[model samples]
Target: MRLRVHRRGLFGWEPGEDALAGAAVTTTECRNIDLDRMLDPARGNLVIGARLPHMSLVFDRDARGPGHHLIELDDLTTKSFARLDWPTDSTEPFTISQLGPRRL
Candidate 1:
């Protein structure tokens, strides 16, 4: 999956899923995203079996300081996904990193 941000909005495309779709993007002033709280599992447990896909995200030029937006899955034909709001300080710069533990 690849994500691109333009004048219109955020756009994502995944092979074998759908070509591309308009994404809901929100900008907020916050830091430290809790994965469990953002993505609630149907089993009432945070640790549930889910298929995580590879993603490539590109931020907008105006967005700065590790800015993050919550992306929701609304398309039935494509692999839906969501993102938690990330923190960004005015003094700092925007940076994106891959979350989760490393494989040993």
Candidate 2:
């Protein structure tokens, strides 16, 4: 993924346009990201024994601190998934890890 912040928004830092603005900035890119293992429905408990159905692995980005990503696996069935208790809802199938400052 690449990042280039130009201005700060109400919510958080906003991304710049296609081309860089004034000062040339370093485009940070995360290379060779393998999501195969992390995209498994079974990993999120959305799969049953020998009964894998149509599912959707969805993800939403949040530039907020403490949580940068919100990934969820939906079985697409009528059954509803449990709701998260934002403040303290970090558990299995719904966990968060704090990856500190980026290291070269």
Candidate 3:
């Protein structure tokens, strides 16, 4: 599935915490963000990272499958928002920090 961050005030995956949103089944082999989906008209106005909380993206295949995995986004560093040129290629890595008002 496509995993994306939820709005800051939205219900998180766990109690008292923020969560990410997912839709459409897709492999996690591509380590990149779906900017198009993030900027979808129906998803609402884009506020960048300030409106989103840093969260992990868990990838799994059933209860006992081999694809089980997790990506802890808070552990990585990203470029400043002003430095981003808006990567057009879907394959380009998009770190959560890049969505924020400043570099993480």
CA lDDT for candidate 1: 0.30
lDDT (CA) per prediction: 0.30, 0.29, 0.30
- Which has the higher lDDT value, candidate number 1 or candidate number 2? 1
Model 3 stretches astray by more than 4 angstroms: 1-33, 44-81, 90-101
TM-score of 2: 0.28
RMSD of 3: 15.2
All candidates' TM-scores? 0.23, 0.28, 0.23
RMSD of each: 13.1, 17.6, 15.2
Query: Candidate 1 versus the native: TM-score?
Result: 0.23
lDDT per residue for candidate 3 within 1-104, as digits (tens), equals: 22333321242323211222221122333332443454443552244333544433222222233432222222122311211123333454432322333432
Among all windows of 10 consecutive residues in model 2, the one with the lowest summed lDDT is: 2-11
lDDT for 38 (candidate 3): 41
lDDT of 1 by residue, 4-103 (tens): 1221124344323132223343443433333334334443122221332232222222232344433322222243443333333333332322222221
User: Where does model 2 exceed 4 Å of error?
Assistant: 1-36, 40-51, 63-67, 82-104
Index of the highest-TM-score prediction = 2
Q: Show the lowest summed lDDT stretch of 10 residues, model 3.
A: 75-84
Candidate 1 has its poorest 10 consecutive residues by lDDT at: 95-104
